[model samples]
Target chain A: MKILLIEDELELATSVLDFLKSEHYLVELASDFPTAYEKAIVYEYDCLIVDINLPGGGTGLDVIRALKKLHPESAVIIISARNGVEDRIVGLDLGADDYLTKPFHLSELNARLKALLRRRHFGGSSDIVFHEIKIKPAERNVYIKENLLDLTPKEYDLLLYFLSNQHHVLRRESIAEHLLGDDADQMDDFNFIYSHIKNLRKKLIDRGCLDYVKAVYGIGYKFTDKK
Target chain B: MKLLHQTQRLFFRGVLPVFIAAGIVSFFTLRWVFDHETDEKLLGVQAEIESYVRINDTLPTFFQTVFDRWYAEPMPTGSMTNLKAYTFSDTMLFNKFENEIEPFRQLRFPVKMRGQIWMVSALTSTVEHHDLVLILAVLLVTMFGLLLLVMLWVNRIVSRQVWQPFFETLEKMRRFRLADHALLTLPPSSVEEIQELNTTLENLAYQVRQDYQTVKKFTENASHELQTPLAIIQGKVEILLQNDTLSETQAQQINIIGQSTRRMVRLNQSLLLLSKIENNQFLERKPVALKPLLEKRLVWLEDFIAEKKLELETILVEISLEINPFLAETLMTNLLTNAVKHNIQGGFLRVILNENYLIVENSAALPEASVKDLTARFARGNPHSEGVGLGLAMVVEICEQQGFGLEISFEQGIWRVQLRFRK
Candidate 1:
């Protein structure tokens, strides 16, 4: 998906740019207020990542408000070091689809961006039809031959990770680390991972879906299509 | 700080004194007028009686002549002493004379002639004169009542009218919140002092609002400008990390960039949050159920509670108060976070909730310092402490904005933060 990230912090902007580019998103960056404002008005983006503090003539909030007025179809996400609930609320009030505070990991931003994209553009339907099973990103809706199945947000994220990384042996530690982010290291156990996998497996089985989420046991869970 | 409050105080301070002084002066003046009028009337009566005595043999002869002339009959000899002995009659002279000297009660004259005392009393003493005196007393009382009413009414009207512009200036100042337009529009008044006051307050409010706006804009611009370069530098480091030729030392450099970037991000966040609070952007308020929300937050912090090895105590009562829910939550969170964040490993968290008040007390490892600066942004006891200092400041802002009262006290090394809701 095409996205524009308007931020004044060079390092943060570049880091975000690199991450999105690596993720194969068509990403464009603007380091100052006027440049970003000019670019936003000129080009139509699927989504916009804006920072509240902007350089040059205009504010990030102003940009959001102006852009939303111009392009109502495009989803907007506010990324700011302003962790004040007031700022978040104001951004939200100004038609931002989501707000992410600074000091956030790229993965978390990506997750939030993906969530917003799905909600704004894809009607929040994260269902990927792969032969016999359909996977929904949000609502954790899983369907096999037209039968619906329930999955939690985390469980759904985990399944999507597996699907994206099919044919690869996902390490348990890496999976846990990625799933919980910085908070994973504080925990003494990863048993919750196994329990989630088991539940997903059972739910799929009960729904009469094929066994694709294979466990590496000591390592991680993987999704493989052997048809 | 509000204009209304300031004016009310000023009314007590400035204009109130003037009214009180005026009232004291008027009171003395009224007493003097009454005394002078009474003295003049008494002297006049004494002069007229002395002249009548000089003109006639005695009061009895004078009274008897008047009786004969007015009623065409010789009065009984002792009837003059018993002035009230006459029967009832309807006449205008009696009414006019009664009205004129009605207040004079006992100014009778006793004459000595041929070694016999002729005790001559007023013919109208028990009837006409008594009634006249009663009417005069009533007239005096009525005059006094009218004077008092006029004085009070005039006092109220004058005080109110004179202070009208003052109150208007106060109202304009009151409506000046940080979020709204700060340009003050003071009402014009005829009084020089009041006009001067309005102009001065108008200027002050305008200056304050202007300064606030400038600072707000600066904060917004500064943070925005800083983010881009920081983002770019971080991005470049990541790009370098993707190179296979990078050594451990180089990787460490990238890691440093990452850490500092994180810190910058946090610092920027705190700055922005503080600015927002100062700007009063989050002022939307509504009634929120306090008990359930507090319970839920405490439940979420159960993990942190477990890690700290602190004992949790709750004494929440069901109460609902009007406030911004988010700010209320932030206020509670900051209190809890500070309590937990600063506490000793095996310390205790004591939470007490009563009607219109909530108190959170916790034990800390660091010795208690004066918590007077608790509500100031970045005013932590320890500079290196993890807290951003905006927590309590935000709490204070929310409390002020929502009309809630906040009190902070340290007792026996226990830092106590109390939130008192306006009853």
Candidate 2:
């Protein structure tokens, strides 16, 4: 899935970018008003993450407005440190799907992303049942044969993204960009993605559930129904 | 209840009764003196009549007794001439003594009996004419003078004594301050009414100031406490968003967290500002040039105007105002920002300044609401705008504090906000 991130901070943006690449989402980044404004108009994205205050010229609010005009079907989440009631109201009124204030936990972000994706793609259903394991979107739940699979917020989002593209190989850049946006570049390494995936797989197996997440050697991971 | 009414009520209540008592006492005393003067006059007349009776009875039976009989008759009712005819009768004095005693011709009522009647009447008129009239005049004058002296003397003494407790309490009340809830030191008074009045006033004033202080403290504490949590959340969002490798989906989720934190901060700031305005923190003031100051604001807002695609124009350049510079700047910024921020793209912003008035007119497509409500807190006429809605409210408060008059009007897609200053 192609996603656009509109953020102004450099270090934060690079870190986010690195994390999303490991999760196999195609992400594009714009650090200021003009760049973000141009990128939003030119690209097609399944989801967008935008900040309200941009450095160069316009605001993140302006970017949301432009995005809605260009691609009405695109889902958007507004991020801001403004902490003003009027700012939130203005962002939502411009057709943003959700709003978040700063200093949030990554796990919570991941959980919210999965919820939004399920609602947008599947019209809010309970389970996306693969041949081996059933992925429940409504409950942030996974199950293999009657036993429940425990997944952290990030692990759950990663599993859902892979399930939606079963049997399809996703690139490393695509995963990191999709999950972390412009923030992916800040991490010293992308090893956190391995731990998130590793833990998700371990939890399923430990619960006597089949591991459906498959590594593609040099590329990324994929969920195969034939396995 | 009020100063004037209390004065009048006490005048009638305490002073009026004392005045009435004085009047009654003097009335009875003056009546006694009047009766004594009448007794003295009656006694003097009786002594003279007795001497005349003794002189007549010893002289001779016929002549003398007849003269005595004449003197005893009540003086004739009409005039002195009729009474003289009886006193000068010829048959009473052997028929020939009538001409010899023409001296009895002037005998009068309120008779004096030491000399010839005619001679006594002439002498009385020359020495003390209308003696009875003189005595009555003297008595009336003295009685009225005594009444005035008594009224003034009583009012002075009784008013001072009766009002002493009140004046003392008032003096203490004047020294009372709200810095501390000090207990009043009331002088002991036997007057129950005055004691009650002092107690009630002291309690009322103390309670009102206490409530005011409590409300102020609550607002201060609430504003301080909210800032801590807001700062924590904002900081955490900044830290998390610094991490890499978030899917396009993960980054978007963090964005929502940041926006909520910002909203909280703005609410806290606005609340604090409102409290400061209420507490009269902007009391210190100085003269400010309004027109140039407004222009300076436009310079700061130039970038915003360009981004919003608004056109600006100014009609007048110089007008003086008296206000705190900080408050004045804040007020102008809020007004100017609202005009441009809420205006339609490519809308015109016009500012007009005169000696005592300022008007800002901008092109707007505001939702249907009364112009009066635009200055209310949290009243967002346009839901799409990203404003905290405290801008115009702050402007209204500053205008009131600085003693400026505000007027708002809308017509033909143009909105006008006018502020009038004292000359």
Candidate 3:
């Protein structure tokens, strides 16, 4: 997938650039609004990760407005340090698909980008199939072979999150946030993460599926098909 | 005490005594002057009798009437020497006609009549003087009473006028809210002291607001500035996590750093939210269905609640409140999360929503004997919990900004928090 990253902060921009590039996407960097605007109008891209604050004579919102007019079907995501209500509403109302606040996990960002691309390209008709595990986005169902995986709503979401970002380490904090937006404020943070994941893993194993989950020591759970 | 009452107290303790004392002194001075004049009149009578008796011997014809009584008596052995000068005495005399003793002013004087020293005693009825003094006393008391009343009334009016601006300032201060946008209203005052008071008060209010804004802006800027670096750190750690050749210790260190960075982000966001609430930034209002919002929030805590097997009870009433929908959802979610998070194992968590209140009650493992400040910042029952320790503090800020009431109580291992919705 082709993606455009418009950010002013050099270090953050580099980290995002490297992360997205490592994800095997054609990621282009535009550190200023003018370059972002020029490249966005001149090139074709699958997704645009725009920061609300940008230097060079224009804000990220302006880039979104200019490029969105040219390509209304483009997947646009707004990342801002200004996470106020009005900022989020303004970005979303301007046809941005999602609004991610600053200091976000790049894994979460990648999942959002992939989801946005999938929806934009196939119109959500694509059934995400991973070997024996299958997730139908339209029907909101997961299947292991012929039998439906009887998973709770939380388990279902956790599985989908794991499937999308397979082989990537997912932090407990990020997982909690992804599951519960602001209510991810858990008393025992890892307990809720552990409870849901344990149940999900048990359900998957009982469905006669090989365990594709690995605990990376003290880091977080990882989904990999290796051994 | 009120200013008026304080001044009136001054009149009671200080001015009123001086008034009473001056009245007494004046009454005594008037009596002395009257008595002196009467004594002089008696001396003239004595002299007149002496001259008459000397010029035409054989006791001058004198009629004894009730109004005037006089007598002549030869000097008794020692009495003549005792009468050196004219003497006056306040004595009682009996009158045959009246058949009652009447007060009299008597004067005795020694006189040489026809070459003989005689004691001439003269008496006059003192009923008139007594009547005059009684009337004077009555009049004086009436005048002083009227003066005191008038003084009190005048003092009341004068104090009310003198202190009018002061009380006005007090009332304006009482009604002033820091969250309001308007400056403290200090109306013009003519009194120099009052005007000075107003100036000082206005300055204090302005300074307080300025400091408040400075701190608020500082908090917001700090939070915003930290966001980029925090994001960079987390991003770098995530990138490092994908390294295949990294050792176990290196991976753990990277993961720990990423977790701490994520925590810092949550902390920053929470602080930003707190300052925003204090700033009254959420102003949009709408009628929100609260039950559904709470039900939706509770679903997020469902896993933990079930993991501990804590019984959950939610009794909600169909009530609507006019508030910012975002704030409303946040308030409900925070309250629910706090209740579920702190509940003990096998303990019950109950949520009851009334028309104007929402109460969350849960059983605690270690019940505090006294009331604790759960709403204070970073006040967590468990320090090691994953919470940012700002949940209840944010709830308190939202409630305070929105004019809602918050009450937290712990009784018999039951920790209860009630949010009283403003009517």
Q: Which residue window of length 10 is worst by lDDT in model 3 chain A?
A: A181-190
Residue A165 Cα positional deviation in candidate 2, in Å, after optimal superposition: 26
User: What is the iRMS for every candidate structure?
Assistant: 8.0, 14.2, 2.0
Q: Candidate 3 docking: what grade?
A: medium
Ranking by TM-score: 3, 1, 2
lDDT tens digits, residue span B248-345, model 2: 55655664565555555656666776667766766678888887788877875554566557888898867667788768877777778778776787
TM per candidate comes to 0.52, 0.39, 0.95
lDDT of 1 by residue, B285-392 (tens): 788888887787676455567667899999989888777777677677667867877777788999998886999999886543457666676677777664456667
lDDT of 3: 0.84
Evaluate chain B of model 2: give its TM-score.
0.52
Candidate with more favorable, higher DockQ: 1 or 3: 3
Query: How many clashes (backbone N, Cα, C below 3 Å) per candidate?
Result: 33, 71, 0
Per-residue C-alpha lDDT of model 3 across residues A100-188, encoded as one tens digit per residue: 88878788898888788889999898999888999987778899996788888888889888987887878777787888764453344
Q: What is the model-wide C-alpha lDDT for candidate 2?
A: 0.64
